[model samples]
Target: MKDINEPSTAPLVIADEPVNSEVIKTTTATAKNSSNKKSAGVSSQMQLLALAKNFVLDGGLVSSDKQMPLEERTQKRARIAALRKQENLEAIIKKSVNYCSATEFTNKADADWFSTFTELAEDVSNTTMQNLWAKILAGEISQPGSFSTKTLKVFRAMSITEAKLLAKACSLAVTEQTKRNIRIISGAYQTPGLLNFFSKNREQNITFSQFSLSYADLLILADNHLVFIQETESNPMNKSESFHFNFNGKPLTLTANKSSCVLKFYKFTPIGSELARLISDNIDDTYLQHLKSALSENFSIIEG
Candidate 1:
């Protein structure tokens, strides 16, 4: 017999049965999850309310015009448009900060350039375009005059499709090792000589269409001022002449096998070259092989 006041040496029971430990654990977990969700909802609502308050403080637009006059409604519409533009500018500024290099800016951007940039950038609503704008801003800040105002004017007029076309062109563009001029080499020709007076000059060219860039595409690029209006030929190279070029960021050397080896190519304009700096090197293996195969016939091709 135990004293009535003494504690009993027995497990606590619910309804005269053992409680399920697993069930209790699961119930507690569910309760915690519900609490967390409620807290998260409150936080989100608070943030949204803060934003709404700020917007209202900044002259919020009327949600509806049940009894508003036409003039008043038009004014409200313009205000909203301006506010949206301000928001876009703010977003671009934030994005530009992320791209700032650790190195101090070498020079300050021109005031006129910045003024023009803001005017055009405010109208850019697409995220991709916004990012591009941000990069331009960052680049200008790092090195003033890196991009010309003319380039900005041209780029501002470009559509997304045109931008993509430019990017594709950049991927195919090549530069000489010692020069920054970018060009798209499509063909090579041996100048007509006395031996071929009655026959056409020997030429080897690759169809750009097979590489996903058609002649029509080139025309579009030219119309946009991204490339020259016509295909240009380089001065003929003498026999055994060696040239160094950077193809898709790789070094390539070509030694001419015969005299008067002229290259047919499309040259990028100054504005185009400036914008091309923003593009990364993306090598097209098939196009590279095709170019090499064609050049091999007239010269010795070496790639590194």
Candidate 2:
């Protein structure tokens, strides 16, 4: 895998209108009285102008009005963009902090924090947010060091199949592992077309009836390692034909006539971890207690 920290050779492009200095001056004065404490830093005329200039890049006017100087307009636009970016970064940080502090299963605080994060991630249009969330979830599921490097790589794979493939293809390029894992996991379906169907339609909506049936088959294959086979018995019933060994150290039970599978594993106590960290961090216990109560009231574990 390429080192994430490597600087890209791609060009940086900024195509936006210039900032309006007069507007910044006026906005800063009004921001002084605003309840948003963060914006107060731009209240000073000099600070506001500096911020505007720093934010705005090219010498472009905020408005097409020929009366306004291009520099001032550029400054204004830059300031607005900078402020928006600052707000987004702050929100992400706050969400991450809150997520790290969560202490129980189904905590509303954590859920709320993650929801905010997901929104921000969508806005940012990047994989970083998803990666972070996956890491956090994995941490919650297993003890530190319990998850192998391969498992972590699988966690970061593009999809469930990709993750499994990556686990199996440790000898090859990291990118290929995910694809290989998917093939391995889906290899045993007696219906030879199942893999091809998933490959082609993973991103689309199919007929509801077909989707329902396929979903059941996929679930059985994924959870119970079963392969569905054709038969003739007046009314041949679909039965799970197991072909793989259970590796997760759990009793695997097939239910709903091979439509569902469940496994029992040690649950991670996220709430407990959060609580301990919060107490140690000396943050206000009241917020922590409130979040704990809310989560307890809302979430229930659906074992599978």
Candidate 3:
């Protein structure tokens, strides 16, 4: 795979409007003086002028005049909106190409899927969001069924904050080695059996807040149907039985030291599983250690 840090040589066809000077001025006001402020203002003006040249129609930037008829002004505004959307689409396409592999894909993206993607992506002007859309496009091209239409709709509705929350959850996510099912290992349940007859049933759960992922964040994910609202438990494992799991890309083998050991977790919905593929694996050493300590009570952890 090519390094993502390597810059692309491709040029953007049209640049968006320069960011407002007021935002920059407000941030740097205390650190800079009057001369610096004047230079910042002049720099912003030059950028705006450069942007105007990119959108020049006939001879000048698409600007409205009160002298023109109402219908003409309305048409001009619509044309400008269309041009802006076009620029957004081009920028996303360019970014997507960077993610595409040199190897050709055997399958092509569906017509309906591509159509829906373009309709939704054209209006996404935020650079961060645009990069996500581009990655979605590239993923679909590489493997047509990697993401479903429903997944796309859910993603389109997600705000940057919600997306970040999901990413945070993914950083601590785990999965069975042989299965693609994703889950958050919140706790474990030790069933009332020969090993724990006196204690009845024992349960151990780690609060997500300790790991910087709060319950409120989980509620948001559940509301979005990315994760099940209720906690799920695995089938009881007999003593000496072993299970393999992948945690943040690392493989682990866990063998039950006691009978009726049930692993408790929050399962990801189908939509969640699909979108989770987009998140790069980010290992949390502290979280992993905590999980190991908890599981050590009933199982032996073997890293692979």
Candidate 4:
């Protein structure tokens, strides 16, 4: 976060290398051109990328062949590349903000988010350039709010698609609550060692496999700390023997079955809860209420 204003990198300039200076000078023209005309946007972006590369190569060069030893040159170049990449990322975020101005969702809030992300650009990965840009655009073109800088920083390092899938899966994992916590049915997954719930009342067991989520996707959420997990033998009372959820608007009945005593699963962490609140929508509220009511019918809190 060093200010770009602290005495330009003039000392790093080599007398013979005027190309870097020229490229740097043209950046203003490119940015201005992109700002003034939407038609030239593509060309402007290309130039910005080019200039970014040029800055790294030019900025890292030793003033004289003997000024720095050859052994350290590679390391110096690597550091310069990271700094240069960050600079380029700033440019990209800027362009995304400019493009947002024409969209219905664009507002001062979006601008603030953009600026926040821009400040944190240096820490984000640039490998998924297109995806990053798309996510940025999506944020701007929708509800804009101040996301947790720390949370988003971790998110920026992760795959956007995976984060989205995890979000969707969490939405589907809802179940009518009882004294025991709900275990989502392992739909489409014939994986062994799945400990689930079964009905003790009627002959039928509930399974809402229609709203299935991949086990792998849920694992990713756990890995990203967006969800929590624990592995143990089922010990809670009035839990389930089979892992099934009610698709119909009926209370899901569950009993503990001794078929698979071993268990490995995810539970929510504090951070995971925070993420769920951010990602989950009002669509799940009714379902949650149903679960709570069902649980309250049979479960009660014990006071010490």
Best by lDDT: 3
Q: Pick the winner on lDDT between candidates 1 and 4.
A: 1
Write one digit per residue (lDDT tens) for candidate 4, span 1-304: 0111111222233347455544554654554454434332244343444444444333332345324455565677787778866766766666556545453644445555666666556544443443344355445445554245555665666665665655565564533343124333321111233233333321221232333445566677778766554432334333344433432223443333322222223454444543443342324545444433333322221211
lDDT, model 1, position 213: 81
lDDT of 3 at 105: 51
lDDT of 1 by residue, 28-123 (tens): 345444432433333332333333433333122222322356576567767977999999999999999998988675775699999989998898
Q: Where is model 1 more than 4 Å wrong at Cα?
A: 1-67, 196-201
Candidate 3 regions with alpha-carbon error over 4 angstroms: 1-70, 194-201
Q: What order do candidates take by TM-score, descending?
A: 3, 1, 4, 2
What do the candidate models score in CA lDDT, each in turn? Answer: 0.75, 0.32, 0.75, 0.45
Q: After superposition, which runs of candidate 4 have C-alpha atoms over 4 Å from their true positions?
A: 1-107, 110-116, 122-134, 137-142, 157-220, 228-304
lDDT of 2 at 4: 25
Winner on lDDT between 2 and 3 is 3
User: Candidate 2's C-alpha lDDT?
Assistant: 0.32
- Global fold similarity of model 2 (TM-score): 0.26
Clashing pairs in 3: none
